[model samples]
Target: SQRVMETMAEDGTLPRNAVRIFWSSPGYSHCCFTSQNNLDPKLAAEIESAFLSVTDEDPIGKAVLEGEACRSFVPGTDIGWEMIEKAAEAEGLI
Candidate 1:
């Protein structure tokens, strides 16, 4: 992990070029939220709004965002993961 790499480097424990990356995803891994099918639509919208409202500038929001490795939450879209989903289904992993 990046945190472990930084800590080891600071302590002089990590060797040069210890961490190497061959490839990285173009899109970031994201957290997704969903409600039960029977849940109220208005309540779901409120929950979504609350998540979208969190910003790094707010203390509590900052802590939550840091824990999640994200600076802030943004509105999610189905289109974002459509390709990954299709690939997973093709591999019979979905």
Candidate 2:
């Protein structure tokens, strides 16, 4: 995935300051479009769309999205680990 992102960056498929990535923990992660602050909304949208399009087609990104989907919407998930969930909830509230 990193290699794909690097290649895209090299090829100008994605802007250099496109995103700020964060991993919340326990396999969850997210991307923030920092480009929005520097670029217009349309340009930011395009960059995000391009990134998403490439990632959606990439195997690793597909797997990550699948895992996120399962954890979020599927029944009987490991999401019920209350200790971690409570921490996440608490932090969000703060």
Candidate 3:
């Protein structure tokens, strides 16, 4: 899982302010925590709700549990590669 996060960071696919990716032992339950700076709490809640909705949808949770990775993108947001690299470095994942 750490390798996957590092790959995403290297590939510039990780979202802005993405702080951590956690994988559970059951191999299905996972959560991504992001930095709260410059973000609205309500919006963050909405995004988390959206993630949960998608995860709860039929077979999506199973897919996420079994699949390689789960991704989220905010339209019009530009998450530069530098941020990803920094995140990877901070986590010692690079």
User: lDDT of model 3 at residue 93?
Assistant: 81
lDDT of each: 0.79, 0.54, 0.59
Q: What TM-score would every model get versus the actual structure?
A: 0.65, 0.27, 0.32
Model 3 local distance difference test score = 0.59
Q: Write the per-residue lDDT of candidate 2 for residues 1-91, one digit (tens) a residue.
A: 5545676889999887686445334543342224324578787667656555544456777786665543222112344457865887989
**TM-score-sorted candidate list, best first:** 1, 3, 2
How many steric overlaps does candidate 1 have?
0
The reply for model 2, stretches above 4 Å from the true place, is 1-24, 30-33, 55-94
In candidate 1, what are the lDDT values of residues 2-90, reduced to their tens digit? 65667688888997578865665565656777556689989878988999999989999999999988878887665667787799899
Total backbone clashes of candidate 2, pairs 3 or more residues apart or in separate chains: 0
Off by over 4 Å in 1: 1-13, 80-94
Model 2 scores a C-alpha lDDT of 0.54
Output the lDDT of residue 52, model 3: 53
For all candidates, the clash counts are 0, 0, 0
Q: Could you tell me the lDDT of residue 68 within candidate 2?
A: 50
